[model samples]
Target: MKRSLRRALWAGAVVAVTVAAVPVTTAFGAGTVTTTFTKAQDWGTGHETRVTVTNGSSATVTTWRIEFDLPSGTTISSAWDADVTSSGNHYVAVKKSWAGGLAPGASFSWGYNGSGAYKAPLNCTINGAACGGGTTPPTTTPPTTTPPTTTPPTTPPPTTPPPTTPPPNTGGKKVVGYFAEWGVYARNYHVKNIQTSGSAAKLTHILYAFGNTTGGRCSIGDSYADYEKAYTAADSVDGVADTWDQPLRGSFNQLRKLKQLNPHLKVIWSFGGWTWSGGFTQAAQNPAAFAESCYNLVEDPRWSDVFDGIDVDWEYPNACGLSCDTSGPNAFKNVISALRSKFGSNALVTAAITADGSNGGKIDATDYAGAIGNLNWLMPMTYDYFGAFNAQGPTAPHSPLTSYTGIPQQGFNSDAAIQKLKSKGVPASKLLLGIGFYGRGWTGVTQAAPGGSATGAAPGTYEAGIEDYKVLKNTCPATGTIAGTAYAKCGSNWWSYDTPSTINGKMTYANNQGLGGAFFWELSGDTSNGELIGAIKGGLG
Candidate 1:
């Protein structure tokens, strides 16, 4: 699940129109510019907008600015592609240094989130000249009908028929789990636990939770924990002693030994998690260079044997996560294409993507289906759809397989995401369902069922409002079930999470949906006896 601090921005249907171009001759320069305002999405109180500035002049544009006025009550929340500032009802957007100097006939766009009803901006101007040739007529009609009930087709139909049979479920079905690099710290979860807990025997692959994206290249998140720290035989995977002069002695070496015990296990180094995702924006600028850097780092001679492939866990592409990204829709496809080109066809390349199934949501923000050809599989982060992020009342299940009445947001469940992706031409066999090993809850709740009021985040060992299943199982025993998940109310606190039984149901849904497999967030959350992992393996079988 996503742990970044960002407000839940619901997706809505997009309505795009090409406003007529207007020629503006100014003392600064003479150019023909057109401003296209696209109502990208609107979820009642909040909406998203995309504005494109086109240069029709013969000369190149070095610097540009746009000015507009919002409706009486509307206000901008967040923006991308340009530096935006507002005063009273006026908003000014200036091109970012990176986006400056547009060649003739070129175009650049920026998007933003706004409050209140959607309204066309007034007095639109580009380079101090009238926009779209004239002022945009005021829009009184409400933003296009509520977000569409279904996701409109984004990709064209394939020229050839899709395979009639599902991809071979090699070795039954894939059971993937993440191994966090930082877990060896206060969490004390070492690679050796995967073996002692019996998870290795049942797992198909292990995703080493993160390599970093820094300076537009693949870098180490924690050098000491990743490969420098020494582990004794007691804590090592192969009961091997680490010599003082050894070049590699940390988790990377331990993973290498784990593969010896479980040959079927494949390890993939994932990059750009919530904390490290900011660099992806820079990477998208030059995907080939980024891919080359990743190839070199993953196959770094020292521990090349440890990693089977690369997994890009970009919190999101062409959308907002920890930081806003304005790389446009093809950014993700371009990056994956470069990775596939550099890594070659034999290496396993995958990605963990957003599960925002809402109309015009993150799913529409990128060309995911177009990139699937280069990927071994795509994991939709179906959990973390809802959490204590909205600290107020109206609590709901965080990872629901299906939607139910009074759901906090529409199209936020796992099923909705899966259906949307399939509709967008992503083969069911290439998609993996995501499961969370922890639970989200609230404190001071009076009612037992969801939608109850809460004082604030529930107390947790590491962070407020979140607790691992290992602790949640005993701390807050299951009291009932809702939306294909488990919930419990112990004292004034109310918690909602998934259990073995719920995972069984989710796995059954995955089979029915013809999904490739199921993958969970991390390994440390399960009990020492591998209770949850057992359920996953048993259910997949």
Candidate 2:
């Protein structure tokens, strides 16, 4: 009789185990990928927390499925990266594209919009154990601190809050440029060249791009390596190791070197690009929490010494970029609000926004003028007029400041964009005119001078029909100006841009219009001696 009962107990245990496995379906089916979640601290206002995911095991992770179960009382207000679906208290993010199927040892990340407290997951399972994590290690909670029984009166006298320093004078012109650290390899330029060439000295603010926001991770690419080398070169010039690197080193260290050389340059980290901007829509839900997380990462005493400001280079806030963000008009303002509250007035916050001037482009999707009210400046990328995208007969003007007859694309150029912004209530002093140092042209066109028919757009190294400004200056000289902007003609093709002569005209316009100043696409695209910056300085005079 005892033996019979033992068999029955064994059978019951088997049944219980089968029931537990019911909730676990094949973990990762064919072509499916998985992502796990890790929580981090929220620094302050205008910040959000970071979540990292690692792809384990051998198979390719074509697409990822991430499910975040928020703790009680905490919630998501916005999200960036993947499309999200929430039920009860659980938030799930899914990838739209396979993204080349992450290889073994590859990892991708995403961020969350959360509020209140943060905690680690109690029950977590990612694509089988081989793909990683089924059980979390037990964590020890620290004992609560006891307050002193009888506190003495605090020392009465102390220092007053320091006076706010006046923002550095931009000489009535906001100095701006895209500092491509990677140019060290392909274009061969250094940050010091920016300094000695008067590029750094005549400037007001600098944008150090692309730390990558798509994966919700802060990583340094090869370009970061080049930036490091540039800093080393700058230090050699000063003959002293930068005093700023004591706290943290890296790109920020290089920025410190630039500052030491000029004492006037302000560096702002620009997050996201055409490729990485999709995550921002997700991050917008919990705008406050997301801003707090960004604050911690940017000012994390670890690298705080290197940065004086933060800039959002989100391609579009409400509409679409390389990826679409349908989060609505308030998404951008909400995010910027969180940042301003957390960082206060001390840290500079700004943005680069859409320049599409058509009747129904990105500008129509959101209220940009309102969002930039608190910004130090607004940069409109006013180039990329015509490329191989339109392979038709009527070759249009690539960089015309204003619309003209025989132009290929309708209602696209700098003038329409500027007028739109001004009409929308954006103060002229807050707007910085964007100038491209390069030219866009078509190669197969047989016509001569400014207007002609083309077979296709000129081919480019990275994108179709684009060339650096420095190259264009020598290849094409100015033929005329439409409205304080320059255009030129090459044999069988037409190009538009601002030379030193035309840059002076742009600066004059900025001054007359009470506009902030002029900014260019990049620093390396200028002449070896930085003639563009010189023109800006000279023109502002």
Q: Name the top TM-score candidate.
A: 1
What does the lDDT read for residue 531 in candidate 1? 91
> All models: lDDT?
0.74, 0.55
Q: What's each prediction's clash count?
A: 0, 30
Which candidate leads in lDDT? 1
lDDT of prediction 1: 0.74
- Give TM-scores for every candidate, taking all chains together and pairing residue i with residue i: 0.71, 0.64
lDDT of 2 by residue, 235-353 (tens): 34344454443443444555666787777667777776556677678768777776777787677665576667777767677776666788998888777767766776457777777
lDDT per residue for candidate 1 within 132-206, as digits (tens), equals 423332232122311111211121111110111112234346789999998899889999999999999888889
lDDT of model 2 at position 274: 59
